[model samples]
Structures are given as C-alpha cells and as structure tokens.
Target: MSRALLARNGRRALPLIYGGRRGTDTLSGVHLAARRFIVDMSYSAHFMDFKGSSIASSMKKLVVTKLSPNFREAVSTQTVAVPTPGDADLLVRNRFVGINASDINYSAGRYDPSVKPPFDAGFEGIGEVVGLGLSASSRYTVGDTVAYFGSGAFAEYTVVPAKEAVPVPAVKPEFLTLLVSGATAYIALKRLGDLAKGETVLVTAAAGGTGQFAVQFAKQAGCHVIGTCSTNEKAGFLKSIGCDRPINYTAEDLAKTLKKEYPQGIDVVYESVGGSVLELAVNSLANKGRLIVIGFISGYQSASGIPPFKGGTLPVKLLQKSASIRGFFLPHFLGDYREAMSSMIQMFAKGQLVCEVDFGDLAEEGKFVGLDAVFRAVDYMYAGRNLGKVVVEVAPPSVSNSKL
Candidate 1:
C-alpha cells in the first residue's frame, strides 16, 4: 500500500500483523515494529502533504511604503495574512521572482500616479500552485508549476488569476524570463518592428534582460544585429548571442563608430537606453527604418524619472529619413501574451534559445536570498552588473528526501 494510505489506516493495519503462530497474545514484538512503521509512514505523509499545501497563517511580502526614486528606500517587507484565493485565483508559493529595470520606475510612481503608497511591489513570479480556488481547480491543481504576471510577486505567496498564469514544464527560472522579458522582445519586434531578413538592427542595452532576447530574435529573423553595452564582458555576451557587431559604447565612441561602420544607416533600432544613446539610434536610422522604444533605463534612476531629451528635433530627424519611432509597454500587449509566451517556452525547451538567469548567487559582494535580498538584486540590475535575467530567490524547494 502507498505510504499515504498506510498512514491513514495505521490503526486498522496494526492488528493485522501476526505475532506468534495465529492467536498469540504476546504481541509486543509485532506491535513495536508496526508502531515504528506507522510513525515513519505518517511522517512521510505529512511531508508530502505540506509540499502541496501550507499551514502557515501569514507570509511576508514587500510593500512600497512610499514613493521614492531610490528603490532601496521605497520598499519594506511586511508580514501579512496569507491571502486566500478567490473563486478564479490560484495561490502560488513563489520560488523565484524576476527583476526588471522598471522596478525603480514603479517605486517612484511613474507608472500610475493614482496608486497610493503601501502597494504591492513586483511584476512577475514563477512558483508552484499550493492552493486552488473553487473554479481555479478546473484548470490547475496543487503542485502544478506556473509562471504568472501580476502585482505582489515579491511575496512568498501570491494569488494570481487563473487566466493570467501560464503552466510550464517545471518551476525553473528560465520560464520566468518568458513572462516579461522574452514576451516584450518577441511581441514588439514581430508586431511593431516588422523585422525583415537582411535588415540591419541596433539594440541598445543589448545584454540586458529583454535586450538579450531582442538580439537573438533579431538574428533568428535573419537580420544583421548590432548590440551596444557598457563593458567588454557584456559585449562578449552579445557576440555569443549572435550579435554581428558587439559595440562596447564606453570603450569606443558610439556615434563615430556607427557613422564610420554603417554610413548607409541602420534599418531597425530596438532602443532602450535613453539620452545620448537614443539620439545616436535616431541619427543612424535608414530611410523607412523603425525604432522601437522599449524603455529608458538611463533615466530611470534620475530624480525626474526619465529626463526629457534636449534639442527637441525628433520630428525633424524622423522626417529627414521617413523613419518612425514606436513605444512598447508589455501591459498594452496582453492580448498576445499566451501565444508569445508559449512560443518562447517551446523554443527554450528545444534549446533554440538561451535563457540566462542571474540569481545574484555568484556576486562577490553577497548572494540574493529571501525578500531581503530583493534590494540588492535591484541594485545589481541598475548597476549593469547582471549578465541576463536577474531573479531573486524567494523560497527554495524542500531539500529533505529521507525515506522510511
């Protein structure tokens, strides 16, 4: 019988053990052995049960106590009652949470001004379903792994709508990238950029979370990809990811290099870093070229939150070459999420794409663990220290494997 079943029927099962020949009253030996077996079985049952469920009454989650340009000062961890799932929600035990450049922007109330203080502080998380609501049970079961996009992902447990959560093969960090980073790149380039074969593409912040996917996708689309980064290490990463030209902008003057190397101008630009870098991309756009603006990380930390560009000549520049600029925000493209996420996940599983995750574990300063480590992870991202998708480990899986 299974250990769970044996544990449940321990009392009835104990009497069945034979002591002496048949009806011997000296049952001490059999009783002792049965008791030990029952104890072991019951413990195993409890361990397995807890893995699919939780008995804790409360959990810790990061909350934005106030609006601040500095991410470290804006959020604080607070213990609150574990939220019960709504009829259409699933309670997930978060394993790992993805970090993004906009984390600081959200903290500064840049996304929504009406959202007051003390709000949830995260965007996406990958975890196992620990509890299913009445209607959610129809689609999800306990122990099923899912990656979800919702508020409050920085918590140990988060309640996500059944419709928003995408089931994955396993609860791995690679799947987390598909939720936001991968989706943004795939959807933006496919829908807006209109990438074509033989096109010359430029990706700013190319080694960043979303930029990595952008570089690979541009290459897969048969385009010549030029990736820009601040350091040689990131430039090397861009080369490994199929970038035709890995420009370490700090080492070489970006404008001079682009002007000399590609006087014909770039066909498409996936520009993220703002300020002077954005100007460079616009100046280098070819006739009928398209520049997709995904983010402006260079100004995300500034007091003004994304500073305005000087010499407001964007219209003149675009008109000069018949070029256009488009902005991409993930939420506006939610309708295409399932298809994009599925395709990325399939490509990832087939080894056609690389999903890099920086857990902040190998950092020489310290490792990221628990909610407390989120601050460090955010800093690591903005500092341009991370290689790929930066994620914070919230709660690790159970390690005990003792068998009775």
Candidate 2:
C-alpha cells in the first residue's frame, strides 16, 4: 500500500510506496527498521516530497515594497500562493536566477516608465517544468529543464509562457549564459553592431557577465577583442577567454592607450561603459565603424543620473569618421532572438564557445545561494567582485538525483 506523507519543506505530500504499514502500533522488529528508514528519508530531505503530484500551496518570493530611489531598501520577502499556469503557460520550479543591474534599477523604479511598486521581481532564471497547462502544446513536458529570461524570476515558482521557455538537455546547459548574457552578446553583435572578421572590437566593463560574453562573441567573429576593466584580476580573466587585449582602465589612460595602440582607429566599439568612455570609443572609431551601446553601469545608482558626455565634440568627430552609435535594450528585443539563444547553446555543445557560470557551491570562491542572497549578489556586482556570470542557486545546481 501507499500513503501521502507531508514534508517539512511544505512543497507537497509524497506518495510513499511500501507494504501495508500503518503506524508505530503495527510495526514489528524487521518492519520497524524499514519504516524508520522511510521516515528519515521523508522528513530529512526536502525533495522526496517535492516530486509529489500535488502542487505546493505557497512559495517564497521577493516583492517590491514601494517605489524608492534606493533599490536595497525597496524590496522584501513574502509567502504567496504558487501561481498556476494559464492555458498556454507552464509552471516552472526555479533552480537558479542570474542577477543583473536591471534588477537593481527595477527595484529603484528607474527603467520602466509605467512600472509601479509591489510587483514580483527579477528576469533571468533556470528551472524545471513541474506542471503543464492543459491547452499548452506538447513542445514542453513535466521535468524538462529550461532557461527563461523573463519577468517574475525572483520566486521559487514562476509561470513561464510556452513560447518564451528555451528547452535544454537533461544535464542543464549554463542557462546563465544561454539566456540573457549570450543573447545580448550574439544578437547585438550580428543584428545591430554588424561585426566583421579581422576588425578591432572594444568591450567596456569586459569582466562583467554580459561584457565577458560580448568579448567571447566578438572573438568568435574573428575580431580582435579589446576588453577594459578596473582591475588586473578582471583583465586576466578577459585574456583567458580569448580577449586580444585587456586594458586596466584604472591603471592606464584608456583614451591615450586607444589613440597610441590603434592609430588607424577601432573598427567596432561595443561601448557599455558611458560618460567619458562612450565618448572616447566614438572618437577612436575607424571609418564606417559601428558602436553598439549596451548599458552604462557606471552611474546606475548615482542620484545625479547618467555620467558626463565629455566626448570632446561628437558631431564633428562622428562626421569625419562616418561612424554611428545605436542603443540596444534587451527587453525591447527579447522574443525575436530565441534563434540566437539556440545558436549559442549549439556552439557551447560543440565546445566552440566557453560558457562560465558561478553556481555558489560549484565554485571555490564567493558563494550566493537562495532568494535571500540576491541582494548580496547585486552588491558583489556593484563592487566588481565577480569574474564570470553571477548566478544564484535558488535550489541546488541539479535536482535529478533527488526524488524531486
């Protein structure tokens, strides 16, 4: 006989398979040992019951408290009912969430013009499909590991629309790279930047999650990738990932280095660092060079707003060089680029592209686990502490071995 046993994690009650064993009253000497083993496994490990057919009633989630200029103070945790998927949606049990500056900006109520407070937080995440909506297509099934860079990722369980979820292999792909970071690097380079072979490419803040991916994509395009970072440690990582040159911006004058090293001017400038850096990249662009503006993290938390645009004189410089600057907002261009995500994953599978992700326990360095660690991850990024993509393990790296 079988019985449903509730777990401490509160996910759901598990249906335990065994002989007709009731309670302590019905236990014999040999049966008592077997019952005790089952009980220990049930109560101790959280996942045994998470695999239960019945869904969790409530889940842990981070919600925006109020609209404040400061992101750190604007959010708090709450226990909420797990959302059921709509007809075309899938119910995903999240394992990890990749932190980005956008999360901080969102909490500060900066980016989205119409966004208000008390909303679910986050964007990029990796998880498994636990439940499927009835009218949804069979393209995805329960237990399929998937990656999603969408809204409402700061919860243990988030509903992903069928069209947005990117299915991966049984062993999880480095979803941190395949989702947001990889898409930004691949799409922006091909569609907006128009990268070419043998051309010189400059990536600002190159040690960052998206920036590192940008460096690799630029290199893979046969461009000479030059990365700029604040520390030598970050610069070293850039070189290891196929960067041609890594300029320590804090140690060297970026403008002077660019002018002296490449008198012919740069061919493609992937300028994410703004202020003087943006202007400098524009000034150093070769004839017909294209500059793709990703994001300026230099002043994200600054009360004074965007950094100074001291690019000497923009009109005269760009007119002489015949170069153009275009801005890329990933949210504005998300769904249209699933093809790029697929390409990145295929390249990774072939060992052509190197995808490095920090999974807390998976790495030897700093670790950030669970929803509560998100704020610290943001601060780590702000402090330029991460060498690769910073991913928070909401659950352990893999859950397949566990009954859940």
User: Which structure among the candidates has the greatest TM-score?
Assistant: 1
Off by over 4 Å in 2: 1-50, 53-55, 171-173, 359-366, 397-404
Candidate 2 contains a number of clashing pairs equal to 0
My TM-score estimates for the predictions, one after another, are 0.86, 0.82
Compared with the true structure, the alpha-carbon lDDT of candidate 2 equals 0.72
Among residues 3 or more apart in sequence or in different chains, the pairs in candidate 2 whose N, CA or C atoms overlap within 3 Å are none
Show the lowest summed lDDT stretch of 10 residues, model 1. 24-33
The Cα error of candidate 1 at residue 82, in Å, is 1.3
Superposition error at 300 for model 2 (Å): 1.1
* Collision count of model 1: 0
lDDT for 19 in candidate 2 is: 32
* Per-model lDDT: 0.80, 0.72
**Model 2 Cα lDDT, one tens digit per residue, 171-274:** 25375666777788778888887888999999988887788888998888899999998889888888899999999989999989999999999988887778
